[model samples]
Structure formats: structure tokens, C-alpha cells
Target chain A: MSKGVAITGMGIISAIGNNVAENYQSLIDGKKGITRVEKIDTIHKDVIMVGEIDITNEAFEKKLGLAKDNNYSRTAFLGAVAAKQAIADAGITNINKYKTGLISATSVGGMDRTETHYYNYLTEAEPRKYIDGHHAGDSSQKIAEQLGIEKSLVTTISTACSSAANAIMFGARLIKSGQLDRVVVGGTDCMSKFTINGFKTLMILSDTYNTPFDENRKGLNLGEAAAFLVLESDAVVKAENKTVLAYVKGYANANDAHHQTASSDHGDGATLAMEKALKVAGLEPKDIDYINAHGTATGNNDLSEGRAIIRVFGDNVPDFSSTKAYTGHTLAAAGGIEAVYSVLALQNNIIYPNLNFKTQMKEFNITPQLTLKEKHLDVIMSNSFGFGGNCSTVIFSKEA
Target chain B: MKKVYINSVCAITPQKTFDNTQFLEELIEYDANVINVVNPVYKDFIPPAAARRMAKGIKMGVVASKLALKESGLENVDAIITGTGMGCVRDSEKFVSAIIDNDEQFLTPTAFIQSTHNTVGGQIALELGCKGYNFTYVHSGISFESALLDAKMQLELDEAKAILVGGVDELGDHTVAIHKLVNHIKSENINSNALLESKTQGCVFGEGAGFFVLKNEKQESSYAEVVALNTYNTLDEESVNEEAIRFLEENNIEASSIDAIILGNNGDVNFDGYYNKLTSKTFKDIQQIYYKHISGEFNTASSFGLWLGARIIKSQILPEAVKLNITETSKFKTILLYNQYRGKNHSFTILKQC
Candidate 1:
């Protein structure tokens, strides 16, 4: 297999931690960030638990040093923060030195602010500034401006929960195809009344800590967070002598086509995504060290993903776990944070425990890694499935 | 690199462009600031039960994709990629209003589920049972171009045989009202025929869907060869001319060789200067074409521009309604498209006769 796109740096901000080191520490200590909603005002606050970050909109604005009257939304704030961290971690002082681009993912662009000033925009002039930030691309544009990236290939992707995975996939393809020498890719989403009420209507918002792969798994806890990864082409890596964290080995996206919001009983789309991703990586199931499962803890997702995992790995499934228990299901950012976690696992030669796994799932005999285990790791496979039957799998390896 | 071909194209625009047999044969004149698609009989394309729940954006996308697929003589493509600026805005507005007006009580999932940006792409996949690669781009004006670029890359690499790509956006009442307050929509209603002449602060807002089937293999029905495409997040007015020249040179084409240039002049005086730089200097001598007059203006309105480009290449006819300049070419072989919105997300796409 050829050398894949090199991941020079990664940064993330989730309920579990504000940076990579903090998140890794929490993972090893078996700490979770799930709690009651604190940021957004919602009627379901008592009935729904979320992995909400502690930072306030004002605090973020202050940190970014924006003007007092700036119209930055929570989504844009989180995305800019995470993307800036990624750029800084990459040790690149000049952003436009090479042909660079940004690909961001977000399901809720500026809805947090939109929903807040929905009616106020008509009567109040102060809140009307947010009307320009309502589109899903506005956050990406803001992030790009924050990074000083100009007149380049900057775009946004929104494929529901699998959005960030597709963003990373597209970024990898861009580098592999020589479209850009460097690219920053990931996703961000802030908690909003729109999402909380939306999931509530679907009856998928768990009122307690999410339990992944449990027979009595309640449901997924919605979260708000952002994460970004910096991918560099092989030429840039060699010329700059950059420290390679890991290589994006393979990625694939497939549609379940079974339902609008539900996965098929057999996880046909998930199975195909995994199988195709492995093929692209030129690796076999036996070669994978760990599997970062898309165990959203939702009744439909866990079962469907579990079955797809079994279908791909057969009897000898690799040790796998879901980090959602620590950060909840962060919607668009789930794939991005999980990717960071997968890279951390490969670098440390460790497999994170599926934090809230309890009873074994009855449908399958397989179970997730229940405790932290250190092993010689090389390749890891990560799965992210979302609404609209969008399923994606991305493989990372220590060796290109 | 393999050549990517636009095998078939279909669009449901403000004009009567849905029927592939007709190419802008008749234009619908609208005197409103906010215009809607000249909708086809959606029931003829979708089942009543499924059609009832689908928002206008979804219906337009689904019908356009089906028609494009039918014209390509394929039951399903290997992947479905879509782009939208404000995806299912109607549903999103409904859900948000219900959350606020109802005090978050007794709401259903239909509106919320359909509010996602990928709902249209997902619905098209469901209708075709296409369990392959799927993606959705939502980057304002570049949304459709982003999707087109993704499909171009995959087809060039021979990763997929055929891909279905489209862009669709629907106007929401709340969204229109908000945009009007921000001056993104025209303050006064103007005749569609006088869009460019209006010289107003904002163009008339409109909504529609445009879909195309792209494949690596050229067929008898192929409309045009997708030569090259590029997008920029930001550009100065002065740099647009230089950027256009550089883009064409990088593709090994010259300005003199371009048969026609399709400019997205939506009559927004504040931002149309980006196109004016090219029309007044770089591409002044080439055949000039404009479509926003008939299609109105939206984020994905450039997709309609692309449809016109591909249709002209296939039929070798430049409708009198879309011509912007007197310069005429004996053969419509190469065409260039330039588009931007609100002075950002600039893009250029080149199409050639196959």
C-alpha cells in the first residue's frame, strides 16, 4: 500500500476535556463528562442528560478577542477554537505557506443563536446580526477567517452524524490527489433547543448516562463539542520534516437506504462502509488492533453497529469500544473526536474502555473492551453512522 | 486522468426547465421579490404518501434526480451527492417555531427529521436503494460547486462509474423575512426580465433544484465534458480577473479559446462587481450569457447556470432569452461559468463539448 495522508496535529474540545491531553487523561482515569444540560434553556432539562462544555458564549468570545458586538455563534466559536488549536499544534506559523484548505462539518451551524433570537430579530436590532450566521457554512467561513486562510478551497460538509468523518475523508482525498499540500478537517456542533427538542420528539434522548452495547441501553445523550485534525501531503511532510502523529489509511461512506432515520436490521450500509474502508487501507480484519465503534447507545444504532461489526470481523472481532460514554454523542463532532481518540490509542498502544458498558448485548455474543488495555497497536478502525442512513468508516495506522 | 462527462441533466427552476424536451422554450415572468419554482406535477414523480411528508426541497431534489437517472438510462448510480444552502428551510423554520410557539410541547419528528441538511440526499438514496457513497455539501454559494468538484474527483480517479449530484434549496417565510431585514433580499418587487437592469441592493430570492448524472464513460446522451472547476472562499474585486485568467491557464485553456462565458449577474449592485471585472475586461470579447434573470437568485442558482451551460453544449443552441451580449460563436464548444454570492464563496467551472 502507498503512504497515506499524514496527520501532523489534532485538537479537540469536548465535555470530557478542552484539549487532547486532558481528554487522554480522562480516558485513562475512566472519567466521563455526561451531566444535565447547563447551557441551553430547555423544558427537557430534567429529563435529558448532555455532555455540555463549561465555556459560555461570552467566555469564548473573550478568549477569541472578538469585538463586543461580534455575531459569532456558539458553533463558530467552538469551531474556531478547535481549529486554531489544531493549527498551533501543527507548529505552522504561516498558514498560507503551502496550498491549504479547510473542510469543516456541522449539523447545527448557528442554530443556537438563531433559535435564541428567532422572534427577537424582528423586534430587536442587536440580535439581527446573527441572521447572517444562520447558514451551515458560516461557521466554516468564520473558522477560515480565524486561521487567516484566504482565497482557497474552503468548504463545509453536513452529512448528519457522519459529517466529520466525510470531511476527513474528503480532506484525505484532496491531499492524496495533490489538490492541496495541507488541509485542516473536522467538525463542530453546539447544543441547541432545536436539537434537544428534535431528539426528544424521536424519543432517543436518554435521561441518564448512556450505556453503549448494554441490553437495556436507554438511548444517546446529546452533546456539544468540536474537533479538528491537520492532514499534510507526503511531500509537505518530508520537506518540512513534520512529526507524523498517524496516517489516515482508508475511509468510505455508504447509505443505509433502509429508512430515513433508522438503520437496517443487518447494518448493510455499515458493513459495506467497513469492508470498503478496509479494502482501501489494504488491510485485513485480523490486522486491525482496535475498533472505535459508533455506539451512540441509541437502541437502533448500537444494535445495527454491533451487527455490522460482527459481519465485518466475523468470529474474531478486534477489541473495540465507544468513547461516546465519555463525551456523549456529539452529533457532527462525534466522528472527529473519535478520530482523535483512535489516533491516541494507536500512539499510546492502548485501547480505551467502553465507559458505560454493562450487560452484554443479547443479539450478539461479542462485547466491547470493558477496561483499559495496553497492547502493541498499529492499525485502528473507526465507525460513525448518522441520520439519513449515512454510514462512514475511517482507518488510521501508525505506519503509512 | 480520466475525462468526466455530464451524461444527463435536469432542473426544476423558476422557468419551465423540468421537461428535458424543452430548453427555455417559455419563461415565466414574475414580479415578486420572492419567487418559487415552477413546480412539476410532483405526484407523477413521487408516491402520495411519501410526497406528503417531503418538503419542497426534497421533492424537487427527488424528482430532478429521478429524471436525470431516467435520461442516463440507469436505474441507480453508484453514489448520491447533494448540496444545499438552507436545506429544507421550511421544515427547519416549522420545527423551530413549534419549539418556541408551543413552548416545546407536543411536537412531532417529521419536521425535525426533515430539517437535516442531508435529508434530500438521503431521500434520493432511499428512492433508488443506492447503498453506495453519499455526501452533502452546504457551503453557501459554493455548495453545488463543491458537490460537483467531489463527483469530478471520484470520476477522474475511476473510483465510481456513475454519480448523481444535485443542489436544492427552498425559501422559508421566516428566512425570507429575516434576509429582507438584512438587505439580502430586494426591498422592492421587480420584473424578472429586468433583473440586471434593476440595479438594486439585492436580487430577487428564488428556490429550485438542479440535478445531473456524471460518469467517466461518455455516452450518446452525454451533454458535455466537465473540463475543470475551482472555488475560492474569498477574493477581492480586482483579483477576480487575475484569478479567472490563472484558473483557465492552469487548465491549459486560453481566454480567446473560450466559446462563451456564463456570468452569474444577479443584479445585486453591491456584489455583482465580481462578475463585472470579468465581463468588462477579461471576457468582454467572448459570448456572454446570463441566467439569473430567468431563474432569479439563490445560493444554488449557479446549478441552474450549469444546466444551461450543459444544455447549450448538447443542443448547440444559445436561447435568445439568456444572451447577454451580441457576440455570437459559430460553434458552442467551450463554456466557462463564474459565480459568487454577497462577495464571497466565488467559483469558476468550465464545460466543453464532448
Candidate 2:
């Protein structure tokens, strides 16, 4: 068997918490971070809910120690903060000591600033500073600058919700292919008026608490977050004798080719992705002890993904749950955050409850694990499906 | 290790490049700061119902990919990977403006759905009904290079047999206006032929799509063999030449062996120095070619350079319109392409005749 990519450290900033420890604490304590909108001024604030980070832009700027005229957007702020924490968590004193690269993923990017300054840019000069920061890659560039990673392969992916999953997959391939020794891979997205109104228009923004795998489930609750993981090659791990958090054993990206915004009814793409990932990991369906589903609490996603699970795992399905109840659907960052949770699950031998799940859907006989459970886990599978029929599955293991 | 070959290539740019039957035999000159692509007949590639809802970027990408697949003689590919710097900015602008104008009331999902960066790739996959690997890279200038690297690695590993890779970007009025405000778009309109001589602060903004079918095995219609590709987030003016030498050395190539080099010179007086440094010193004797004068400048404009390089290697004909210097090479065997936006996202790509 081939040696797997080693994940040495991880960092996360979400509605549930600001750091890895806090997020772990909230997950174990059954704390939910979903609440009514507080940061953004939108007309639907009363009718819609979100998982917004409590910190403000000024607070983030202050924490990062930026100049008064710094043009870093919320996406950049969150990405840099999380990536820096990941670098420190890995206990690397010199970022450039080993050949390292940063692959960040984002959907909103600097849209928050763009939407705010769209009109102002025409008449004023101050907001024009942010104009350069509007593209999807700007946040990644800023994050790289903050991490002190220069003259390295730095890129950004934006496959909607499956972006971070793809980033991790690509990072693993880079390591496996001997392209780089160390790579920091994850995704970041901040709450923005553009996305808020975008989802609102799609009619997928749940007004109440999102309930995944429930017959009465509404749509998803939008959230903003950033999460990152530091992946090192076997050579680097051996040289440094690092603490391997987990092994990124398998990953696959598949297109449903069914719809633009919705998933296939039978989840063909999700099934293909899970099967291919398992094949890559050289594991059988029974080998997976737990499954962290891409249960966005949306009506279409849960059904399609649940059916896909049934198609792949068949009669003998493993215990599965969705953590969106805790942090909501974080869009592009969902996969990264969920990967962190999967690692935490493998480390602690715990299974987080699918929060807010009430009634089991009639479409499938299987139901999500509604409460926290402890078990001896060896392998965990995480699924993240997105618009444009993008389906991704990443398998994590305790052993290389 | 398996060898990756460019089976077929297609491009739709500001110039009349979509036909592929001709290669810069006729040139269209413009005297504007911003240019739009010379569009192909949408009905020829996409159905009327679908084309009506599609935006310019999506249409261009879909048509270019279709043509590329046709040239490769494949009904579908194993995967689709796309790169875009701004994505469908027009739809994004439309959605955002509607939200602001309507105060988050009575908004439709069409524009919002199409604004995603992967919509082009997703659309291509859907059209082909190919449920395979798909990805989208959104880094500024290296977006297309990132995609190319991913496909190259997969092909080298024999993980995938055939992958469709492309880069596309479209201009939106609001995007252009804001860019002009920041001087990313030239302040004054200049003739296309005078782009380099104008010595302006910013480049003439343009948009287009370029797609290629990459396979693990060489084909009868192969254009070129992708030798090596690398990208850097930052490279100073002084270090660019040194980095170029190091890159060639890493690939077991010598600077003297290179027959031609494609440089991304967008007529920006400030950033074009990145290319000028090579033209004057390191690669002074090599045949130099520049295309942004005709294709205009976009984030993925380097894809045009790649298209030109692959065509030259296959056809062994260097168009006069793209020649930067009078230096001529009798045989087009090995070509190197260097591109960057502003001063960041530097890339070096080497292509060889198969």
C-alpha cells in the first residue's frame, strides 16, 4: 500500500469557535452557533438566520495588526488568521525552511468589500483601494503574504461548496507526486450581502434552525468561516518526527452532470465520488467507521446525499451525522471545517450528533446519529457536494 | 511516467481566432482601451434555448471546449478543469446590483447561479454528460497555469487518460469601470498596433476563452508535448532571470537549446519590465514573440500565448503579427512561455515538438 499524506496540524475560525480547541469544545458540548444575522445589515435579517462569527472587521484588523489604510477584506482577514494559526500549530518556526505552498479556496473572496463599495468606487478614491482585492484569488494572495510564504506555488480554487475539498485533494496529489514537501490547504469565506441575497433569491435560506435528514427540514442556514490544515510529506514527517494528526487517505471529485444548482435525484455523482475515494484508499465500504455527511440541511442535498450513501454503503451503513447544526453551511469553507472535525473525531474516538434532526425522512430507512457517541474508529469519510453538481468525498484514517 | 500531449487546441479571442482554419493570416486592428471577443455563432455550438440564458464567458468556454473536443475526435473527456480570474462578473454584477437596487426583494436565481467560478466547467460536464473529475482554479494570472499543472500531474501519473482544460474571462461594464478607476485599464485609447510603443501605465482590457484536450498518449493530431510547467506567487525583477535559469536546469534543459520564447507583454510600462528583462539579457538571441497586442490583456491571456506556441510547434510557422523581435529560428522545436499579472503570479511553461 502507498503511504498516505500526513496532516500535522489544523486551524479553524467559525461561528462555533475561533480556534481549534474552542471548536472542539463546542462540538463535544453540543453547542450550536446558528443565530439571527448580527453583522450584516440586510432587509431579511428578521426572517433569516446565519452562523456569523462574532468578531467584526475592525476587531480582525486589530488582531492582525494592520495599518489604518490596509485594504484587507473579511475573506483575507479570516484566511490569514486561520492559515497563520495552522502554521503555528504545526510548530514550524521558519515557514520557508522546507519547500511549502499554500492552496486556498474561496467563493465570496472580497465580495463583501466589493458590494459595499460598488457605487462608492465610482465617486470616491478611498474605496478604489479595495477594487484590486475583489478577485477570488486576492484573498489567497493576501493569506500567502501574511504567512510569509514567498516564491512558492500559491493558488486558489473556487468550485463553490466543494472548493476546500478539492484544495486538500490537490495538495495531497502534490505531496504524493513529489511536487512539494509541505502544503497548507483549506478554504475561507466571509459573510457578504451578495451571498446573503444570492441564497435568499435561490429560496434555500432557511428561516429557522436547519434540520438535516428530517422530513420537515427547510433549507440551509448560511454561515461564514475559514479552516486550514497543514499537510506534510512522509519525508518531512520522518525528518521532523512530527505528530501526525491523521492521514488523508483518499479523495475524489465527481460531477453530477444533472443540474446547475441542485443535485441528481439519485446522487449519481456523490456515489461515484465515494466509491472512487474508497478505491483510492484501498478500503471497503465496511472499513469506514463514521461518515460526516455533506448534509447542508437543504431539502435537495440531504435526500440526494442520503440516497448516495445508501447506494454506496448499501444495507450495512455506518453511523453518519451532519455538523451543520453547529456551524451551519459554511459554503466554500464547509469541507475544510468538516475535515478538521473528521480529524478530531478520529483522534478522540467520538461522533458528533447531527444537531437539530427531529424526524427521519420517509425516503430512506437510515437516520443520522442524533446524539454524541464514542466508538473505536479507524477510518472516517466526509462528503461535500455543491452547486454545478460538484460532489467530493475525502477519506481520513488513523493509520498511514 | 507517462507523457502528456496536447491533442487539440482552440481559442476565441479579441482577434478572429475561433475558426482555427487560419492562424493570424488576417489581423483586425482596434483603437480602443477595452475590446470584446470576436464571437462565434452560438447556435453552431449551443442550442438556442441554452444560449439565451448563458452569459458571454459561458458561451465562449462552451464553444471553445466543443471545438477542442471535436478536434480530438472524442465524444467526451474523462475530466474538465477550467481557470478564470474574475468568473462571470457580469452576472455577479447583475445579481449584486439587483440585491442593492431591490433591497433584497424579488430577486431571481438565474444570475446568481451563473456567477459561480466553476459554472463554465460544470456546464461543459453537463453538456457532455461526463461524470468525471472536475475542478476550477481562480488565481489571478496563474489561473490557467494552475489548471495546466493539475492536468499535467494527473496525466503523468496515468491517473487520467484525457482531460479537457481551458481558461476563460469576460468583461463586465462595472468591472471595467472600476478597473479604469484604479488604472488597471488604460486611461487613453490607443491603436492595437501601437500598444507596445504607447508605453502606457495600464493595458487594454480584453476577454476570451482557450481550451485544449490533453491526453496521456500521443495522438496523430498532437500539437506539442508539454515538457514542464511551474508557477510562483512572487518573483522580483532581479530574480526572474535567475529563476528562469534554475527552472530550465531543473527540467534538464539549457537556455541555448530554446528556439523561441513567448512573452506576455501587455504594453503596461510598469510590469512589462518582467518580460523586457529576459528579452534584453538572458534570452536576447532567442526568437521572441508577444501576443497581448493582438489578443489584448486578460488574466488568462497567457492561454493565448500557449495556443500560439502549440500551433507554431505543430505547423512550424511563426506569424508575423506576434513576432516581438526580428530574430528568426528555422526550426520551432522547443518554446518557453513566461507570463505574469502586474508583478505577481509568475509562470514559466516549456513546450516541445512531439
Poorest 10 consecutive residues of model 2 chain B by lDDT?
B321-330
lDDT accuracy of residue B119 in candidate 2: 95
Clashing pairs in 2: none
User: Evaluated on chain B only, what is the TM-score of candidate 2?
Assistant: 0.99
Worst-scoring 10-residue span by lDDT in model 1 chain A: A1-10
Quote the positional error of residue B150 for candidate 2 in Å.
0.4
Over 4 Å off, model 1: none
In model 1, the clashing pairs are: none
Model 1 chain B: ten consecutive residues of lowest lDDT:
B323-332
lDDT of 2 by residue, B268-314 (tens): 99999999989988899999999998988998899999999999999
Chain B TM per candidate, please? 0.99, 0.99
Q: TM-score of candidate 1 restricted to chain B?
A: 0.99
Candidate 1 CAPRI category: high
lDDT of 2 by residue, A181-209 (tens): 99999999999988888888888889999
Off-target runs (Cα >4 Å) in candidate 2 are none
